[model samples]
Target: MCRTSILPSTVKAVKRGEAGSAGELRGDFDLSGDLGPLYANTGSGIFGRLEEAPRAGAAVPVGMALPGPATILANVRGDEVREYDIEILKVAPSSADGRDLVLSVTDPELLEETGGIVQGMSGSPILQNGKLVGAVTHVLLNNPEKGYGILIDHMLEAAGDGVD
Candidate 1:
């Protein structure tokens, strides 16, 4: 599908509390440009393959470790990118999805900002030591202050068609 992308902006646009209506499509996407070809669309995340040669910059190579300081960029309610400081608590090679890195939200202002991670936050890129390690994939339902991140390397390898 050329015009296929299941973005948070599109998903959030669905109107709720309607009669005899699954949802409504009215709001425009917050993306600067279209999201390319979409391969997998799930409730948890979307897997899309970029349809281009290759672009330089923006994405950093996946880092090997995550034990120190890191930063996360996430869009909580719309297109507003918010930065939060965090510290890697632990890393496990085997998780629910094979490998997952645990993170502790150390940003002093995060809780007061949005009551910790809210909806539509998974897949937020996680940068450690100025390198892209992975993304915030899941947050503990009981404890919102902590979350799980999937290594970028692991994701690229899983793509099969290679990363763009």
Candidate 2:
């Protein structure tokens, strides 16, 4: 299990009714510099068609195990930011076959606001002992309040030109 904190500058909000579809959320952060070039191919030739289509019914994996008491500072009703304690119930890895970080939350308030996962919260950099660990990804459809995260090391590695 991994524990991390949220960076202030990383916090963003999606206007109540303006969040787009899931695909939009995944691409919310500009990961080009971090993950290298993402490609899209439509040609029929072998090399030209290297980009594989996203799985039709596959779920992105979350990683690690559920963490113990985590603190959530979220805007509750009346625009008041409230803090709550959370426990990670589970974690899955990212779906990219790369080192992605994802996890499940056990906090009710956060679950409600994010419906497990929401936009504007995608790039919330998670920290542990002041060290970045990951960023929020998406919410699990079956459990709307549970979300995914991308491991910080993976993000750093991707961003660092793949240096160890």
Candidate 3:
């Protein structure tokens, strides 16, 4: 397979809204880059011993990193506000082409408590369609609930991927 190497520093966090805003929060992530080899030892048979390496530059496509100082559009209860530091473990290809992306969150508690996805989970980078698809935008934060994602194309197109 392909072998890619990404530095840990590649990742960055995107904050949402101002601290004093009505709805404000922030999310952390590991930027896309050349990730080292990921072992695939199933222990099924002798062949399982084979160590598989990732493709070179296997990180999510360029321009996928969500911009900083993002706005979190989420509904909160009471006046209790909390922020979380999220780690993006993996970004892989999706079945669809340029239409859908697959993103894996490292924290299971967040997933279990919030179902599939949760609030403040938006703006998370998803990797699929061979490019930076978008970021998580919303979440149910309740039963049978999942999170929502927004296409990066529009954000990038509007922001121009450059800050003044």
Q: Which candidate is the best by lDDT?
A: 1
Candidate 2 residue lDDT tens string, 1-164: 43222111222343321234331122133323231222221111001121344334343333333344443434434434444444444344445632254455566656545544555445444443323445655555555455566665455445443222
TM per prediction? 0.71, 0.44, 0.33
Ranking by lDDT: 1, 2, 3
Q: Which ten residues in a row have the lowest lDDT in candidate 3?
A: 41-50
Kindly provide the TM-score of model 2 when superposed on the true structure, using C-alpha atoms. 0.44
Per-prediction tally of clashes: 0, 16, 18
Model 2 residue 25 lDDT?
A: 22
CA-lDDT, candidates in order = 0.63, 0.41, 0.36
* Model 1 stretches astray by more than 4 angstroms: 1-3, 6-33, 41-45, 50-57
Write one digit per residue (lDDT tens) for candidate 3, span 47-130: 111134533445555345332222221222232322222333323323222222333333344333333444344444554434
**Sort by TM-score, top down from the best:** 1, 2, 3
